[model samples]
Target: MSASETTSRRQVGWGIVLMLGASVCYALMGVSVKIAGRDLPLLTLLLGRSAMLVVASFLLLKFRGSPARPGNPRLILGRSATGFVAMGFYYYAITQIPLANAVTLQFMSPLFVAFFSAKLLGERVGTTLLLCIVLAGIGATLVVAPDLSTFGGDSLFALAAAVLAGVAYVMVRELRKTDTPETIVFNFAVFSLVFSSPAVFLLDRVPTPVEFAALVGTGLFAFGGQILMTYSYRLLEVAFASVFSYSTVLFSALFGFVALGEQPTLLAALGAALIVGTGVIVSVAERVPPAP
Candidate 1:
């Protein structure tokens, strides 16, 4: 093998490592959100998380010598808006439902992403993609079915989060044409902070020391995960990196079981398998060249 091929393999190996670390960070973030949400209001949690992100994003931009302003304000705002709303629903779902269930449901964003890209981006939806979507739908239904009896509309909140996340991701794909990742993240942080600030004033409650730590952990973990995942994609193909992204669901399941004593029912576990497995198939399939 050529030296270049050896270097390429090394890069891919490191990328996988970074992606796995990001997944763990994200799973821990979910765990922190679950813990903090037990004592804090959703808005309050959002406010705290957004506030930290704003500060962190600003520092990152400064460190990178990048401008804080977005190159395309319209797309930035759209992505941020959708992401903010999706985050709200996701956090709420984490509090109301099992951590793995909420994570798996939100992980359905890829299925929705495929649909939205075809509709909004004028991308083609091939037969393989359609099959993956159908299987993912069944998986999501199974995950939601078990939660419905106890959590009521909470499970739907996760699904809403997934839908909005799909829109936000599509917007991000478009925004990448003009904006730097730092700029996009900085804009999102500022947007989330400005919009979620109302929660701080509206919900006047003091957090205990434990809750405060958990709130801080939520932002820290999320920021770390975002940065790691972004860097991983820089080293590897998006499709390849995204397959490891599904590892977040597994980490969430393990963390949920260990930290929260939350165990998925047999059906939910099966659903998670379907979603994760179908997601892997879709990611790999998207990257494969069509046979002539």
Candidate 2:
């Protein structure tokens, strides 16, 4: 009858579907942030988002009054550390790289997820998932294919984001055993505030009405997505949840075209198709027997 127990009892298919919906909403958050324009620095946006998330967490606790604290403050603190590192990298990378390239590379987090799941979660890795990994790498390559001519620095930023995001996600995967979504997200906001303290002086300008809205959206969307994702893990294995996450790519691409006018080339499109196909396969891949 506990929240964790309720989560664990939900059907895997439904959990995944919910996560997918969360992913789609997350992608739209990007679009909304874009609409707010470059006048709002990424750190400022992150800072505002952090404040909103912490408030949201407190409200959730006050409203339910359930025995919701995950009982391990240390675990929550650790997740906060990972969020600090991951969001720092992600916010920086997105600023440096083309949206498409950054998102493509970010998807590579699934590879790290699968590998970590096998080593940390003791899940058996299979050939199907392995191929999926290869395919996702190829897709990421395609996103940066344009840079092959000029060898842009965006690739570096994008890849760094990808790596750090994976590390943060592994932290999330670990935290799930001890913390609830509310705790994890609450910690994220706390860390964001702590991390942004040094840069507070730079935010001398008052955030525009639009910028404020975007920051609020970032908190709400990101928190909601995290909640759905937490519920998702309770239903299925890590790798499945990770791969299902790539649905964000499609929405990202669409948003890029519509909002930022960053159009993808035919090659990029082809590569994304392959990557998406691979992601789907990996998400649904069967757990193969161990090498006998």
Candidate 3:
């Protein structure tokens, strides 16, 4: 392979590693939100999380010497608007549903990303990618096993969150044309604060000391995950990066089992296996040359 090819492969490898770390960070955010207790309103938790994102984003900007303003303001705002709404619904679902189930539902965003990237970015979704996505969808369906018996508002919210998140991620892929990761995150933080603030006014009850700390932890993990994910997308295709995001579902299952005392059903466990298998398939597919 040529030197440029070698460097590109190396960057892609590192991007995958960063995204895996981001998956872990994001999974842990759910644990923190769960621990923060149900008394904290969704918007209030978002307020705290966005506040920390603001602080972390600004510090990152200063450290990197990147400008605070996004080069493409309209795209950044659209990304932020979608992200803010997605996260609001995601947080609400997290508080009401089992962590693993909630995550699996939202994890459907990857399929949407693949679809939209093909349509909007003109990124090719080959036969292999299509098959992998189909397998992943089957796995996700097994994990959720959605039925009237188990379905509720939380499920609806999680699905909405996934769609919005998919849109936001595609916007991120586009914005990376001109925006730094930190600037993208800063704009997201600003818009999250602006959009979630009004709901905070209706929320009652201050967080206890432990709840307060967990809330802060949510933001810290969120910032780390957001920045890592943003950079990962910059290095790799959105659809490709999204394949690795399945790791978040695995991490969420583990966290739910350990922290929340939620045990996965046998079917869910098998589904998790398929999810992991798809990640492995995606990794291998990237490295292997196509048949002549």
For each candidate in the order shown, give its overall lDDT on alpha carbons. Answer: 0.76, 0.67, 0.84
The per-prediction CA RMSD against the true structure, in angstroms, equals 4.1, 4.8, 2.9
Best by TM-score: 3
Q: Answer with 1 or 2, whichever has the higher lDDT.
A: 1
Model 3, 1-292: lDDT tens digits are 9987778778878888988999999999989987874787777889889999999999999999999988999999899988998998888888888777778788889989998988998877778777888788777777656332566777899899999999999999899879899999998998898877776677666679989999899999999999999888888888888888877877887887888787767777887889889878887775532111
Tell me the lDDT of model 2 at 10.
49
Model 2: worst 10 consecutive residues (lDDT sum) = 283-292
TM-scores for all predictions = 0.80, 0.82, 0.93
C-alpha lDDT of candidate 2 relative to the true structure = 0.67
Residue range 249-282, candidate 2, lDDT tens digits: 6677777888788777787787778767875665
Q: Kindly state the number of residue pairs that clash in model 1.
A: 0
lDDT of 1 at 19: 76
Off by over 4 Å in 2: 1-10, 32-37, 63-70, 147-155, 279-292
User: Which regions of candidate 1 deviate over 4 angstroms?
Assistant: 1-21, 122-148, 229-244, 264-292
Candidate 3 ranges beyond 4 A from true positions = 144-149, 287-292
Q: After superposition, how far is residue 150 of candidate 2 from its true place, in Å?
A: 6.5
In model 1, pairs of residues that clash are none
Question: Best candidate, lDDT-wise?
Answer: 3
